[model samples]
Target: MKTITLIRHAKSSWEYDVSDIDRPLSTRGENDANLLSKKFIEYSFAPDAIFSSPANRALTTCNIFIDNLNVSKKLLSVDEKLYDFGGHQVAKFINNLSDQYNKVMIFGHNHAFTAIANSCGSTYIDNVPTCGLVMIEFEVDYWADVKKGITKMTIFPRDLKD
Candidate 1:
C-alpha cells in the first residue's frame, strides 16, 4: 500500500515586509502546529519520508511535527516542487514519488493540498485548512500507479481546539 499524507502549512504572518516564501508562521500557527503534531502522534501514524516546501511557514510547520515526533532530521527534505499553490506541481510531485517509501508526508500550501486530498482521496474534503492533515492510502504498490484511495484520516487544528 502506498500512503500519502498531505499537510497544509500553518497560518503565516504578513506583518513582515517579505516575500511570500519568507513569511514566517504566526504565534497561533506555532501553537496549532504543536497541537496537531502531538495529536497525530497519538494516532501512531509515522511517515517513512517527509517532504516540505522551502517556504518558511511550511518548513517551520514540518519541523514542529519532526520535533514532536522525535523523527530524525535526515528523513526530512526540502522540495521546491511542494512550493506550488496551483496544485499541478504538487500533484506531479506526488505521482513521481519514489516507490521505496510507502508512507510519505508532504507539507505545503493550498488549494493544492485541498485539491490533492479531494482528487486522490476517497472522502470529500471541503478545504484543507492551515495545519490540516489528510492521509490517503492507495491499494496500488507503486506510487506512479496511485489513483483514488481511501481517506484514512484527517486532522485539523480547529478540531482540537478546546
Candidate 2:
C-alpha cells in the first residue's frame, strides 16, 4: 500500500513587491502550518519523503511542517513541475515517484490538489484551505499502480481540529 499526503501551500503575503512565486507566507499561515504539523505528529502520520514546490510559500510550509512535526528524516526535495497548477500534472508526477518511498508528502498549490482529490473519489470541501493537508491511501504496491477512484482515506485540516 502507498500513502500520499497532499498539502496546499500556506496563505501568502501580498505585502511583498515580489512576484507570485516569491511571495512568502503570512503570519497566520505560519501558525496554521505549525498547527497542521502537530496534528500530523499527533496522528503518527509521518512521510518518508517530502516533495515540495519551489515557490517560497510552499517551501515555507514544508519547512514549518518538518520542524513542528519533528521528523528527523531530511529527505525533502524541490520539484519545479509541482509549481504547475493542474490535477493531471500532479497525478502524473506522483505516478512517477520511485518505489523507495511508501509514504509521500507533497506541498503544492491548489485547484490541482482539489482536482487530484476529486479524481481519487475523495469528497474534498471547496478549496483545500491554506495549510490544509489531505491524506489519501491507496492499496497499490507501486506508485505506477495508482489509479483513479482508489482512495481509502481523505483527511483535511478541519477534520484534524475535531
Candidate 3:
C-alpha cells in the first residue's frame, strides 16, 4: 500500500514584521514539533521522502522534525505548489506525485492540509491544527490513483503533554 503523511506547518508568530510567507514559527510551535517527533519515533512512522512549502514556517517545522528523525537531507525537497493554502492546488500536487515515493511526508499550510485530509482520509477531521499530522494509506500502487484512502492515524500537539 502507498502511504502519504500530511503535516500542517506549526503555529506561526504574528509578532514578526515579516510577510506571511516569511513568518517563522512561534516558540510553542518549536516545542510542539519536538514533541511530535517523539511520537513519530514511537509509532515508527518514517517516510521515504519529505516535502515542504517554501514558506519559512513550514520549512522550519520540517527541519525540526527531520533533525529528530535522523533522516537524510537529500530526501527533503521544497515544492512551490505546497505553498498554496487552498486544498485544490495541493491535491493536484499530491495526485501528480512520483510513484517512486510510496511513503512520503508533506509539510504545508493549514486550509489545504485540513481540506486534503478530510477529502482523502476516511476520518472526518474538522480541523488539522497547527503541527497536526494525518496519515493516509491507499490501496493503489501508483500515487496517481490514490483516492479516499484509510486514515491510519491523526495526531496533534494537544494529544501530547506540554
Candidate 4:
C-alpha cells in the first residue's frame, strides 16, 4: 500500500510586500504546523519522503513540521509542479515519484489539494484549511498505480482539534 499525505500550506502573511510565492507563513500558521506535526506523531503516521511546493509559505510549513518532529532534512524536495493549482498536475507529479518512496507527504496550496482529495472519493469541504492534512491510503503497489476512487482515509485539522 502507498500512503499519500496532502498538507495544505499554513496561513500566509498578507502583510508582506513580497509576491505570493515569497510570502511567509503567519504566526498562527507556524503554531498550527507544529501542533499538527505532533498530532501526526501521536497517530503514528510518518512519511518516508516529503514533496513540498517551492513557494515560501509551503516550504515554511514543511520546515515547521519537520523541525517539530526532529526529522532529517535530507528527505525533503521542493517541486515546482506543486506550485500549480491543478489536480492533474499534482497527480502527474505523484505518479512520477521514485518507487523507493512508498509513504510521502506533500506540502502545497489548496484548491488543488482539496480537488485531489475529492477526486480520490474523499469528501472535503471547500478548501483544505491552513495546516490541514488529509491522509489517503491507496492499495496499489506503486505510486503510478494511484488513481481516483482509491482513497482509504481523510483527516482534517479541524477534526483533530477536539
User: Which of the numbered candidates is closest to the native, going by highest lDDT?
Assistant: 1
Model 2, position 42, has a per-residue lDDT of 67
lDDT of 4 at 162: 58
In model 1, residue pairs whose N, Cα or C atoms come closer than 3 Å (at least 3 residues apart or on different chains), thus clashing, are none
lDDT of each: 0.93, 0.82, 0.91, 0.83
Superposition error at 83 for model 2 (Å): 0.4
Screening candidate 3 with a backbone cut-off below 3 angstroms (N, C-alpha, C), the clashing residue pairs are: none
On a 0 to 100 scale, what is the lDDT of residue 108 in model 3?
A: 98
| Model 2 TM-score (2 dp) | 0.90
Query: Please, what are the lDDT tens digits per residue for candidate 2 over residues 15-102?
Result: 9899989999999788778777876776777688999999999999999888887776477999988997887778899999999899
Model 1 spans > 4 angstroms off: none
Q: What does candidate 1 score on TM?
A: 0.98
Q: Higher TM-score: candidate 1 or 2?
A: 1
- For residues 26-112, could you state the per-residue lDDT of candidate 3 as single tens digits? 999999999997788778776888999999999999999888988888999999999988888889988899888889999998899
Tens digits of per-residue lDDT, candidate 1, 78-106, equal 99999998899998998899989999989
Question: Over the stretch 1-162, how does candidate 4's per-residue lDDT look in tens digits?
Answer: 888888899889998799989999889788778878877776666679998999999999999888877778998999999997877889899888888888899999878898888876556457678888888877877888888545555556676675
Rank by lDDT, highest first: 1, 3, 4, 2
Q: What does the lDDT come to for candidate 4?
A: 0.83
- The number of clashing residue pairs in each candidate reads 0, 0, 0, 0
lDDT of 1 at 64: 97
Off by over 4 Å in 2: 149-162
